[model samples]
Target: MKWFYDALNILGGISFVSVAVIAYFGKLYFERYKRKQDEKIKSLQSRLDLTNAEMKSKLENINHVSKAQFDKEFSIYHEIWSCIFEVADSVSKLRPVLDHFDPNESREERRERRLQAFYDRYNPLVVAIESNRPFYFEQVYKLVCEYRDLCRKEAFEYQHYEDYPNFKDYWESHEENMKLIKEVMQKCSEAIRDRIYSLTIIK
Candidate 1:
């Protein structure tokens, strides 16, 4: 009976030791797993932050480039409009509403002077349009070309005014040319306005 008791006591002690060992190892494994999970979370957060920062930078760069492009386009458009206005003014001066007869200037001389004035403005307009050809829409470019052609035709007709039978014939033809020019100018202006409106919306 004594041996049996001793054996029982030894077995109980061994069981206690085994449980303690298992608990200690289990605690260590759990702590290690928790630490690994924390490290993974930190790594993922770092990657996400880097991605966000890069995206922000790229967006800012794109906006800056878009703004610069828009400004350049606007400047070119302004230059074109200025040239058009000058051409319009020259057109008006070609046949003044109130002619001041200078006895010193012959009819041919007056025609030459008016044509020269048109050329002065027309040349600049040509340069502006040609230099920025790529910047204009096809329709706008065509309208400008049409305006140029009309001005040239007016100049040609005025130069050959002596060919006409009477002043009435020449004046009537000149008025018609002026009317066509005015209409084209209006169309061109409206086209430009529409283009600018579209660009504004995109911006």
Candidate 2:
């Protein structure tokens, strides 16, 4: 009986020690897991912060480039438009008297009037833009639109009379004007493209 009681006490102590060791190891594992979790969270936060900064920088660059390009293109568009309108105004004046000459109108006189009208109108806008006057482009753009409108009306009136023998010379001038306006439009488009390219967006 005495031996059995000693053995029981020894076994109970061993069991208690085993349980304490297990609990200690469990606590250590839990602490390690928490630390790893914290590290991962910090890493993710840092990456997100970096990404945010990069995004902001890119957006700012885009805005800056866009503004610059818009200003440049606007100047060109405005100038070209004004030129077209001014030239159109001078050309349109002859529309009212166009029918007065009838089909027998001399083509040379018609061509001279048409060519001279365009020549008289175009120099002012070109000179302004060439001199780099501010806002000159805007004025030109408005004028060009006005000219286009007037030309359209003029074309309607000339459509029937243009093929007549005496009116053939006038057609040359009319066609030349169309060609010039189209060329100017092309110039404006090219300027816009060049301006955008020049901006060179930072990001």
Candidate 3:
């Protein structure tokens, strides 16, 4: 009976020791797992922050480039409009026959004066267009060329005013040419307006 009691006591002590050992090891394992999970969370957070930063940088770069391009285009368009205005103004002053010619001024002298005045404005406009050719749309360039040609034709006709049968015939043809010039000027204005509108909306 005494030996059985002793054996039972020893077994109870061993069972208690085993439970304490198991609990300690389990606690250690749980702490290590928690620490590992925390490290993983921190790493994921760091990676996410880096990705966000990269995306923001790329977006900023794109916006900068877009703004620069818009500014350049706007400047070119403005220059073109200025040139058009000057040339158009000069064209308006052109005359096949002067309304009040100086009695001493010969026909050839008047013709030279008219041509010189037109070329002074027209030449600069041509230079501006040619220098910025790469910036203009094909349609715009063609319109400018057409405008130039029409203006030149009108200018050259100054020399031929005498060839016409009468003043009425010459005046009628001059009116027709003026109408065509006005139409071209209107088209150019509309095209430029549309281009500017598009740019404004995009910006």
Candidate 3: lDDT of 60?
A: 54
What value of lDDT does candidate 1 attain over all alpha carbons? 0.80
Clashes of each: 0, 25, 0
Candidate 1 residue-wise lDDT, 1-203, digit = tens? 88866876787865776798899999999999999999999999999999999998765544222556667766777887788888888877877768776899998888889889888998988888789888656677888888888887887887777799998888899999999999998888887776554453234
State TM-scores per candidate: 0.63, 0.33, 0.60
Error at 170, model 1, angstroms: 1.1
Best by TM-score: 1
Off by over 4 Å in 2: 1-80, 88-101, 133-203
Ranking by lDDT: 1, 3, 2
Better of 1 and 3 by lDDT: 1
Candidate 3 ranges with C-alpha deviation above 4 Å: 1-65, 96-98, 200-203
What shift in Å separates residue 103 of candidate 1 from its native position after superposition?
A: 1.3
The true-structure Cα RMSD of candidate 3 reads 14.9
lDDT of 2 by residue, 2-113 (tens): 8866775787865776788899999999999999999999999999999999999765644334555567655665665576567656655554434455467687687566
